[model samples]
Target chain A: AQTVTQSQPEMSVQEAETVTLSCTYDTSESDYYLFWYKQPPSRQMILVIRQEAYKQQNATENRFSVNFQKAAKSFSLKISDSQLGDAAMYFCAYIPNFGNEKLTFGTGTRLTIIP
Target chain B: DVKVTQSSRYLVKRTGEKVFLECVQDMDHENMFWYRQDPGLGLRLIYFSYDVKMKEKGDIPEGYSVSREKKERFSLILESASTNQTSMYLCASSLVTGGWYNEQFFGPGTRLTVL
Candidate 1:
């Protein structure tokens, strides 16, 4: 079955520190896309970053980056200089290159930034 | 900026009652999706529409149906809301593209309670 797995259900980081959330997906399709989404307490989920499978360079936002290992089907998100406002449930998702446009998301990892 | 809005942020209904969750996007997107977010199970897709009047089943569509009569509007319906159907429902929309990324914008989720 095609699925995404987030190994860490909960994680904590000191304010201004850094943390990484791990994700792995099982799929046989060669063309796909990976994404990290942040859901705040307000229940608004926003896209943090996106990674295309064909791109050798990893995707990076302002302070959010991804460590994508296509061979192992692992795509992890790294949050640098974490802030208290960054505390939220982070989800890892996958979508194929086709137009079906279905996104498979992993069980989220709740990150708590301690002050 | 892309904006996705849901009709409700919180809803309460009795079992066996019908429930309708509406979503609208302002970006003229071609795809809309409905997903239920659970504590440990993650976000499970219930339905999606690639265009007006066209819909497809997602990973979990047993208790749900969808309508996309207008290009900017998509609605998810629960024929008979059950106790097991109580969860956070999220609506998202994305533009149609052929490349590796088609970023989806999400609305504030609706937390439904079946009592």
Candidate 2:
């Protein structure tokens, strides 16, 4: 069984600033995929970024980026130039290379963007 | 754009009532999932289907059943709704051509309150 943990239950960042949400997981597999998802007030979950465990290069999507440390079992999401739209419940999720690709998600971090 | 839609955005039911939640995907995805989200608990998968008429139990499947008779639609059923089951239910779809590594498209969640 695998599990993801988000130690920070809440995080706040001023508009145009930067913030990072921490995540860590327990997995014995060497190859897998990691993802960061955002759930807004609309209750729609959107993919923020993704990283392949084999790829050392971090994944960046516009203002959203991820620092994936496979050895440390850590995958953190970074938001730069944060905007009001970034305010949401951010979740760190992943699926191993086996099974039905069931996603294991962290407890989630509530991000608040202050103007 | 990949679109996933849930039949209801909010539902209120009584204990011991039978509940059905419908989900439809327009992206022709081969994999569909049902998850329940609770505050500070993240999302816990209840069931998933990789093909029509085929389903697998996820982390939590107690008192729940699913149907995937058609490729574009998946349904979750709570045989006997309970107050403990009051939570947000989400539906997601993803392509499984090679594997389940693709990003999942989520629907606007159905918030079910069992009174």
Candidate 3:
């Protein structure tokens, strides 16, 4: 079984500033994947970014980037040029390379953007 | 665009009552998942189905059951609803084509409250 953890329960960032949400996972598999998902007040879960375990370079999507440290099992999400729209409950998820397609998610970090 | 829709945005049920949550996807995905989201528990997988009439228990399936009669629809059922079962239920669907990096699209979620 794989588990993901988000240390930060809540985070705040000013508009146009940057913020990072911490996440870590426990897995024995050599090949797996990590993802950052955003859930807005509308209750829609949207994919922010994703990184493959085999890839050394972290994944970046527009203003969102991940610092994936496979050795430490840490996958943190960095949000740059933050906007009011970025305020949401951000979750870190893990998926193995085989067997199942279900995702294991972290406790989540509630991000607030101060305008 | 892949669209996943849940039958209800909000549901109120009584304890010991049978509760049903419906989910439908438009992309004809091969996989569908049911998850419960709480304040501290981000998303706990309840059940998942890879194909029609094939369902698998996830990490948290003690009080939940699932049905997949059609390729596009997946339903989660609570045999006897309890106060502990009051949470946000989310449905997601994804294709198995992109190897192990398959991405899932989620619905708006159903907030169920058991009294």
In model 1, which regions exceed 4 Å deviation?
Answer: none
Instruction: Give the clash total for candidate 2.
Output: 0
Instruction: Give lDDT tens digits, candidate 3, residues B47-110.
Output: 9999999999988999999999999999999999999999999999999723554788999999
Candidate 2 lDDT, B1-115, residue by residue in tens: 9999999999999999999999999989999999999999999999999999999998899999999999999999999999999999999999882243568889999999999
Of 1 and 3, the candidate ahead on DockQ is: 1
Candidate order (lDDT): 1, 2, 3
Q: Candidate 3 at B53: error in angstroms?
A: 0.5
Off by over 4 Å in 2: B97-101
Docking class of 1: medium
> What i-RMS does every model get?
1.8, 2.5, 2.3
Evaluate candidate 2 and give its CAPRI docking class based on DockQ: medium
Record all residue pairs in model 2 with backbone atoms less than 3 Å apart, i.e. clashing.
none
Candidate 3 lDDT score at position B45: 88
Fraction of true A-B contacts recovered by candidate 2: 0.64
Error (Å) of candidate 3 at residue A13 is 0.8
RMSD of 1: 1.2
